[model samples]
Target chain A: MTNPTAAMLVIGDEILSGRTRDSNMHHLARELTLRGIDLRESRVVSDDHDGIVAAVRALAAAHDHVFTSGGIGPTHDDITAEAVAAAMDTPIGVRDDARGILAAHYEARGVELNAARLRMARIPDGATLIDNPVSAAPGFSLRNVHVMAGVPRIFEAMLAGLLPSIPGGRPVLSQSVRVERGEGDVAEPLADLAKAHPALSIGSYPFSENGVTGTNIVIRGAEGAEIEAALVQLSERFGA
Target chain B: MTNPTAAMLVIGDEILSGRTRDSNMHHLARELTLRGIDLRESRVVSDDHDGIVAAVRALAAAHDHVFTSGGIGPTHDDITAEAVAAAMDTPIGVRDDARGILAAHYEARGVELNAARLRMARIPDGATLIDNPVSAAPGFSLRNVHVMAGVPRIFEAMLAGLLPSIPGGRPVLSQSVRVERGEGDVAEPLADLAKAHPALSIGSYPFSENGVTGTNIVIRGAEGAEIEAALVQLSERFGA
Candidate 1:
């Protein structure tokens, strides 16, 4: 079977405005990679409905899974749920499961569940709620799209709960060889090595730190033995 | 004058495949914020030409400036330059200025300028070269779209050379107040503060650490004084 592909949509005005450094993309990327799911694309969009709708539809259509972070909150700008509903052409209302989750959360904390708090309980029709153990507001999964919280901890918790449920392929295995040579010096030989290993992906990442120039040659593929073989060949050829 | 609005397009198959974690976005976001540019959206597209063309046209039309990172290398998969030219409906050829940069670079390194290496010198008609001090291959700016190298350090160096040429408006200033309270508890007061400060953007980013629930109330605007005032009000209202 082909690898299960995924895309991430980070919805927040704060991210676009550079007011917040986005940690969601990195977290999701690492998690999906570990789970053997290929995260194909990630978009950071504002709180605008049009932007969210356009991105959600495009990414959902392209990938096996579309995970969205942010905008599922109690504030006026929190419009991701509505936008996701619109994108899927589904009707949106307060879901019973989500309401129960929120109600139980507030009851345990001895807090009143007001109208704004109810906003978090709303979900698109025909969706399964993803429990947020860190927060009362639960995320929902509709078809291929998983709408989760923007908060790092809650986002992570929700992902941990959700990723195991999906089917995954072979996890991508990678090995890195740090070379003191520049890319220009090693480009030709590396290109040949890449051609030789048709199944493996060889990338040369050049870096200069503290006046030292080097390239980190990363060889990645599905088979651990093949990746190790390629790394061995690279070390032999390059004298690292 | 209104702030110069910008958007970022990140093109790479590696990023989509979860093989590469993107650092260019954060760097560009911080740089744009420092230069007072309003970064509206960011899209990570595959190395597909059609995807690049569609995103380029749409973003360039909407924003004042469009900065793209990645896919401008000498490799066959590097198709961002051709895609940009196609999107702009402009003819692309090896420009003299870029050729000069490439020639000088190859001469210093004592490397033969092959057809693949010369491919880096090809740029669209009526485009200005953005110098890459770190690497010999220069980035180019066609109209308002600045195409830079995919590597973080090189992209950053190219942007440093390019940003100062563009005039910027008032830089966005912000202040954050960490509140050890749930978003539902602080949502009402934050909303009140947001309503009071129409010019400022008030956002609550909920986070949890070691079972402690809290939100970082970030107030952002072009005016430092206004952001400070909002911060003071938030501190008073939220008991920060």
Candidate 2:
């Protein structure tokens, strides 16, 4: 069976302005691969309402799952929730369930649930909340889109909790052989191998070390035996 | 005048598969900001032909400029040039100009310009070549889309040479004030500040440290004097 395909929508002006370097996309990609989900595409957009709404609608419609990070805080810049709701055509309001979670967490710390803070409780109708253990403000899952925090720590925690519930395909196995030769030298044989093994994904990444150009040929497939067999064949071809 | 809006299309399966983390996007964002170009959006797609074609077409039509990295190399997996050519509806072939550059470099190094290595000479019709100093392979610019190498060193070098030729707007000026309060406490006044300064872009990024939550308010504008004035007002309000 085909692995579930996913897309990531990263929302933040800070990232676009080069004030922040996003690490969540890498983390999500790695985790999704381990769970046998193919992360097909990722997009980073500034904190603009129309852009966020359009990106969400496109990504959500194209992929089986869409994971979004950022613009879901108490600040005025946090407009992701509203945009996502609009895109999904869902009415959103401060729900009691989400409010209860935030209230308990903040009240215990002697923090008041003012109007600004209360905005965190807003959830789209017919959506369920994704728990954020780092901060009390919860992210929500509106349809197939999982809205999570931009903070790396919080995004990681939320993803750990959310992944088990997601259906996954067979974990893809990978193996690589390094040839201390230019990519051009490795290209012909690698192409032949790739054509021979129609089910596997074979790729070449070139690197320069000590003034010597080399290529690392990576083979990936759902069958471990096929990967092992391909590696052996590649090693024999390159005599590495 | 509004900055020329640009989009980035990063093409590589290594990035989407989590085998490699993409750093080119951050580098491009910072450089564009300094050059007064607004990098409005970025997308990462795997080395699939159709996917690359679709992304290139979409981004090229929506933005004033589109910058693409990867998929131009001397391997079977290197399909970006063809995909980009197809997207622009232009024919592509191994041009003599690009081939001459590669032939001289390879011959100087006592390397044969074989079929695999010669693949790097392919350039799209009616395109100008972007010289590569690190490696002999040349990048190309077809219309508004600038295609460059995926390697960080090469991508950076290519960009440094290419940016000066592109028209730009005034460089955006930015200043920030750190408020030792949660985003909730800063939202109302920050929103007011944002409203008062209609020309500036005001954003808040929240952080937690030592169990204390605080928000950093960043103000950005083209006018340096206006940015300074906004900073002073923000400091007075937050006493930061």
lDDT of 1 at A99: 89
Candidate 2 docking quality: incorrect, acceptable, medium or high: high
lDDT of 2 at A13: 87
- For every prediction, compared with the true complex, DockQ reads 0.48, 0.86
What TM-score, to 2 decimals, does candidate 2 have?
A: 0.99
TM-score for each of the candidates: 0.89, 0.99
lDDT string, candidate 1, A1-240, tens digits: 678999999999888876677888878888888878888778899888998999999999999999999999987678899999999999999888888888998989898898779989889989999988876689999999999988787889999999889998888888888889766566777778878888877776677889888777777789999888888887788776
Cα shift from native, residue A218, model 1 (Å): 2.9
True contacts kept of each: 0.44, 0.80
In terms of DockQ, which candidate is strongest? 2
Task: Report the Cα lDDT for residue A188, model 1.
Answer: 70
Task: Output the number of the lDDT-best candidate.
Answer: 2
List where candidate 2 sits over 4 angstroms from the true fold: B210-212
- lDDT by residue for model 1 (B146-237), tens: 99999988999999999999888788887888889877778888888889888888788877779887878788888888888887787788
Among all candidates shown, the one with the greatest TM-score: 2
Give me the runs in candidate 1 sitting further than 4 Å from their true place: A190-200, A209-212, A223-240, B109-116, B196-198, B208-212, B223-240
How many collisions per candidate? 1, 0
TM-score of chain A of 1: 0.97
